[model samples]
Target: MEPLGAGDPIRLGPYRILGVLGAGGMGKVYFGRDNTGRTAAVKVLLPELAHDPHLAQRFLREAHTAQAVTSGGVARVLDARIDGDDSRPWIATEFLSGPTLDDAVRAYGPFGADGVRALAASLAATLSDIHAAGLVHRDLKPPNIVLTATGPRVIDFGIARPEHGMTLTTTGQVPVTPGYGAPEQVLGQRVGPAADVFSLGAVLAYAATGRRTFDGTHVAAVQYEVVHGEPRLDDVPAELRHLISPCLAKDPAHRPTPEQIAGAFAPPQGADRIWRTGPLAKDIARRGAEAARQATLVGREPGSGPSRRRLLRASLAAGAVVAAGGGAGAWWLLREEPRTPVESGLASGAKLLPRSTAQSGKAPKPLWGPLPVAAKPVDGLVPAPLSLRDVVVFAAKDGGLAAHFTRDGKEKWRLPDVTPAAGLHPLTEQLFAAAGTSGALRVHDASTAKLQWELPDADVGRFLTMDDENLYAVTRGGQLLAVDLTMQSIRWTKPLPTYAVRGAGPRAAVAGVTLVLFGDDGAVRAFSTIRGLDMWTIEGQGKSGSAIAPAVVKRKDSNGTSYTVFLGGRTLKALKFPGGNEVWKAGPPQNGTDSWGAPLVHGDTVIATNGTTLAAYDLDGRQLPLNGRAARGPLPATPLVRQGEALWAVEADGRGVSAYSTTDGARLWTWSAESRGPWGMSGAGNRVFLVNDGKLTAMPTVG
Candidate 1:
């Protein structure tokens, strides 16, 4: 860690650079704090190299690669500026407070068998997640692995590329660390997920015995040993030799897969405590606390002076162990900042939402107000609120749609001519698609309410759903249309079945290449997004009066990636997407005639209300207990929403909301409001927005 020298940027994007953590060949990593006081390791490209297109592309690629893997075993990317421009590109990653594997091993001795097994299993799981996202981490070594309170997190994806990508390097440069890189990577050959497995073997061997699997005095000798020479495993334990030796196999094809490594090294129960309970944990905690205290001092004394600079430098130095060991894996202290009102037109990019610290066991007061923002429609159906960045868009009280800042109940903008019945759907973070009174398809900038584009003859009566390429809508004449967003033209239109268009527009959801629709007649249909071709249809999917909302999710199983649609009605069912085949089905509560309402999918759990009881099930149709008594009042047909650790749903009375723990399904608290009939609920930015009888209220979520 060092003081900011001449020519260093004071700020990049939303982050304020406090001090420089370290410098590498391509750029420098800085300790940065955002306006919200969230900390990050902001990596900036060297100004001299910013104009190098190749370096710039690789910098941006690192950001994308790190963001692709969604696992707790990796440092989360907070924000990045990858757009090619005159400004220097930078990436902000959550600062992890921990010592690097190398530092820990140097301070303490080599890990015991239990510790080694735990490390192997955790790293293997992270590798599996990386491979699942179609990437191969080319560098897996001690310095890049951080030991945190939770577990070992793999960091530094600087050279990670697609599984099928060939080894890329500049002239005279090796792409991987000498002792840890696979033989294929050493020979500059094409690599795949197996390459990461080879690196994992080396990492585990080093962890078990403070020695590398392949080592030599010179870099060339180490490379030679990796490609053709036998590994030196004399120091490795006898029981672990067989497992570690196979990983160092000369041929990539002969190496064990990550799953095999994890299963073979299955650590005993309570193995994770190895990191949480040892001296290593104390070291990590001390560094984190000192860094946190210094951050507070710097925040309290924002004035620029020698004393402030010295304090900032000390803070960065205290956290240098994290920066040195984990490279870009360091993160700021995890603490909540004060919630402030949002400025108009500002996008909530990578910003943590303001959360309420209220206990879930008691009712929480409204964060904002039960303002009259929605209109009491003649049909008694209130449109569900939609969140775009910082604003929550809803059906305006007077007419059309209105966008309100989530921080406060202040109205940001409104579109009086936009038809709420036609639907308001976000096209992107900055733009949204809506239907006009004349059935015209229109797109507007979300922040300014400025119209970006429109098609007068699109004849979109109701917006069903949208994807990256097109918007799916329906016409008053019962025709389904796919509007090509890029071309601003109609891609395809097909007449819906006569029974599919009765009452309000068909409830819809998009699953990969398929568009699923639940007709008023309780029938479900799937259509191809490329062309309006019928894929499959299921009859009698819902009960007579049940809301036919279809929840779609993509799940990976033994057969690979497959989309499954969940529906409520005559029975709760999971149907294979596009094919419309029954995957699993569960009957309503035994000995009762109450049918299932719309289902909600969160991770592996699918939740829905059956009569007065709330039930949860795995995707395979196994029931799980909610731990609390079922709702005594009538549960509505709306889908359940998850925020923080609780699942929220419209209460049985149709005028209140209930919170239940997603872990055990125990009812937390109930919020009641006076309302006539239909109620709509949506959650975003750590706040739950509810609309009942034309009144909109914002409530805080448990932190």
Candidate 2:
């Protein structure tokens, strides 16, 4: 291997290697040039990881997803392929030039408020792009943030989770990480995008202050603190307090989502200050802002203050009902609403719960088990927040789309026995989603509370995306269809690629002029919407084995032609839009696989996650700096990016789901999200919708 800093040619997929752009626990990334003389970077997995199929699958997924995504914020993939025999698996991508956030911060302390705000905006926009395409970069941190000449580019997608593909992870294995992990991620609970938001909160906290939120004396202590303790914002400035507070909420449901994060961050800049008061300070401030209230903030000397202290503790415990979780960025959400709700049972039952207390921000010296949470089912939900604009569609335990919303875990709109909850299509701007499971193409319109139309007897696996005009559809039996709007007659029908055995699920994107198709084997067919002509067939070069489903990502480039792509271990392929040219390719090094995610393009960065570790590349395809990372698993769902500064994805192991950030490769947050059980969850809006073994639950992202 050559020095990453030195642009030396090395051996990689159909390309000579160059200097190393960056290095991480997974492997070293080198800046190289492809056979077509196009500049690129090849990611080489570490020798120790080279043989691990889990990491190998993750590697390929990064390539597949990054190549498909075309966004201004993301780096572009040039070429990809796997090396033979003993060679490494490598991914070649366009090179990105910029200074890492780590370098920028070191060169110039903390970024100014305006700079941070700009960075946040860019990252938020980037997140939106990938999220739309359903890709999540599971690791986001400051180091991964790059300040390019054009602007800040978020790069690195090595360990990001993807919507499809499988990773090689051993049974009974535990991942090693730091203080930034969320509670559920640590607990290995069902995870989703919010976990990354939690990581962003940690990264932001570190960026604002020179220290970590839960930097304990030991890794164990730090992990414990991350799951239970309140962070010390003693050094955070006033302007950032509220913005940062929501990210630290204790309950995953309470944390604001990336959208909320961006919205809150987009506004006014507050002065910077260290918070000396405890986590309970906000409660005390609201209850005792006036010195005469004298409950806690105005404690007197010694004996006199003892009673005041007692009152403060009592108040804190009583109000504990409202502690927010990071599923929205856990603990930080605590401040948005008081711990005590207007009519919380916990508030009423505040009589007593054995009185052991600890300092708010300081890590409590461990005695045995987890410190008790102030309340159960944290007050995470926004007070009377509006229901989701899109109605939830789910298959009844037997099979059918069921819609439900909960303000207090109450069902909103539920329609069961609708087959293929995965095949929902929102026809006519109306709410009820349409899809076919076993019977005819069923259209459930929540707006009318009835079935709009049913193309009787035609068993379909899914309904492609739709506008007011036509409904693109695919059946498990290998039939592609275009149904009319206005409940009119069928417009046309065509046979799809035979490889599309599974058929693109209902979530397929079909718009204005394009129809994106997914194949069971890592391939995608982009068709002209109106003509039904196969515009282009895009495929990632993957290893011999059962192939994963495919997806298309939207590339962002003011100048470059839009490209669509997909993922596999160590390989990424990008297809030019309109014409379907093989624009660029990136392959893995020495026995690696492809990237994960459909490959997301945002800003000047192209991201890949969940292959082995979260990784990012500049729009030029160079590897970017990063901090947080994740292991491989089932194809991950696209993440929700907020503030355009970070990307988040859910990490699932046999235990549960956890979220990760792809920007600086940091672990943002986590919650009690579980994998598919008797009753599972679905990915529709930027929230984690769960029906755990028949118990319906919802967790929103904490911005």
Candidate 3:
């Protein structure tokens, strides 16, 4: 170990500086030997930066908050203080004896599943420690992730602090480090643990693959792309792709928390990879030897046919590995033939390659895998962790996103009184419902957790969107219900699609007094939800039961063209509403996987995310950034796009809530995880709410 400098005897805070470890955009970290000659890494804000309020304050806040965390993952805080000198603000932590993640990746190449597991476990443990201290590590990237002799240690708490009183506009400029930062960080919104989880996902990806997620040549361009791009998952390993999606979501509300990320990554399935196995090859050998003994039945025989048979059976039983609830397990029995540890994986049931210690053709490192691409069905995609401040509207299972709340794991309200049972709708807040459930046009008070009123229940919960004025809902039985909230609920019900009620998305919409509904066979019926009269009808375009996008009607063009947008998988189409004529259809929003995150539309730009990337295009089918990598999300929920200081979004990944920027697609923040995203994202108005199969939770954001 090389000492920093000639062991300069410099005194700063509560310790004496002996050498310098490293420096970055934040400040200089020194290898300081305390009065007891104990080496410690003391980080101090650069003199020039110390003069800036945000830099200095954040630096001290990070130290103060980090010091409160007393976890094995955390470097012990020997001593710290904001001394009298204006140019010296520093904190001293015990010197860590490990390689930085950057170094690890450079030295050993990409990490495989084992490395990922170990890294996750260490990080989760660190986040757990930090959370316990009521602090959050706003910037958690690979460079900041360190692998010490003791275990994995998270360093550089320069930006780690309570999520309060912070803004994304630095010097009133947009947030920095676009791709790594979340929307909240971009928008200057208050952040929490979810931000760390998002960062964990990015860092983990970098650890496994040697590339930065939002990597591009230009910083602003990278920022633009990350805030709105998708992950190139075809490059990612299939086994771990599912794990990365949740952490890279655009919505801070949907990204998993550190705990969730940790739990998912450190669980029994792939978690063993995260364990600090000093000698991986030796450990596998030990396990293999035990297996060999079991196959031979030990004392029973030496070179007996029975032993060979058992050994063969044992080898066959090894099969391929799969991800279990929270750990790694065999998915199927491929060749399982006990070859001399030299052959390539017996290409049978292996989900990922078998663990090996050979040189050439060696399986990718444990944590290393291809990047996550668009969503595709993996073993199973679990839910993300939820904070208490997001807004979760209900659909299907109950009603049109009825307002819900929770606290200390208890629901404050779960009322369907807002509207009738509306089929699940995303990217739009307007509520609609179906019959049997409640064909009523239920309007909800998002703030009060109460229903303002319900229109009718005849249409079932079919169409629940708005076009300036009226509300519409249709049932599978071809019954259309509509009501104008501006006026009294005089209610208008129409009947159509008497046969197959297949296609639902992009089905019903209302403009002025015009109502439209599409059927299973692509048939369209245009009528008046306000007056119960037919305007027009036409054939549809997609397969029955395909994801039916909500119908959107816009103003008429010079050619008397009235455009409406509809989505089916990756395809986005524009059609003439009322007239039912195809205008133009763009590509689908997603390709290989499910579009877990919501598809958002803002004016002329239609924004959506695939499994690993976010994309934008004009309604006319033109690419926005046909030039850069995209921000990504297959996280399981719609994101909240708050256009404030910068564009911000919060949504659910399979593992936790996360924040991101909509302006350029930068991830501004994240929270680490110990939970999954099934706890659907919810809440608004000063609080966030989340619910899983078991519990309803509420967390305060503003109040």
Clashing pairs in 1: 94-331, 95-330, 95-331, 96-330, 96-331, 543-569, 634-652
The local lDDT score (0 to 100) that residue 163 gets in candidate 3 is: 56
lDDT of 2 at 236: 75
User: In terms of TM-score, which candidate is stronger, 2 or 3?
Assistant: 2
What's the CA error at residue 646 for candidate 2, in Å?
6.6
* Distance from true location, Cα of 5 in model 3, Å: 8.7
Per TM-score, the best of the predicted structures is: 1
Positional deviation of 372 in candidate 2, in angstroms?
A: 25
Judged by lDDT against the true structure, how good is candidate 2?
A: 0.47
Q: Against the unseen true structure, what C-alpha lDDT does each candidate score? A: 0.74, 0.47, 0.47
- For 1-703, candidate 1 gives per-residue lDDT tens digits of 4567788887788777767777766777877777777777888888898988888887878889999999899988888885334478888888777777765664444677888889999999999999999899888887788887788988888778888787857565566777888888888888998888888888888777666767666778778888888888887888888988888787778988889999999999988776888567776776676556545545443455434323423322323334332334332211112112224333221111223333435677787789977877546667788876557888999998998876577889888898888767776435678889989998887667888779898998777887646788888778999987646789899989767776664888888788988887778788999898998877877644344678888787798888888888778888886577788998854436456778988878888877666788988889888654445465767777777667788876575788877767777778877665778788765567898888888876654
Which lDDT value does model 3 have at 588?
Answer: 42
| Candidate 3 segments exceeding 4 Å error | 1-9, 23-27, 45-58, 82-87, 173-178, 267-703
Which residue runs does candidate 2 get wrong by more than 4 Å? 1-387, 427-432, 436-438, 453-459, 467-469, 497-499, 503-514, 535-570, 589-595, 601-605, 618-622, 631-652, 669-686, 691-695
For residue 294, model 1's alpha carbon misses the true position, in angstroms, by 40
How well is each residue in 307-426 modelled by candidate 2, as lDDT tens digits? 422232222211111111001011111111111111110000001111122112122221111112111211111001112233444444334434443223323454555554334544
TM-score of each: 0.53, 0.41, 0.38
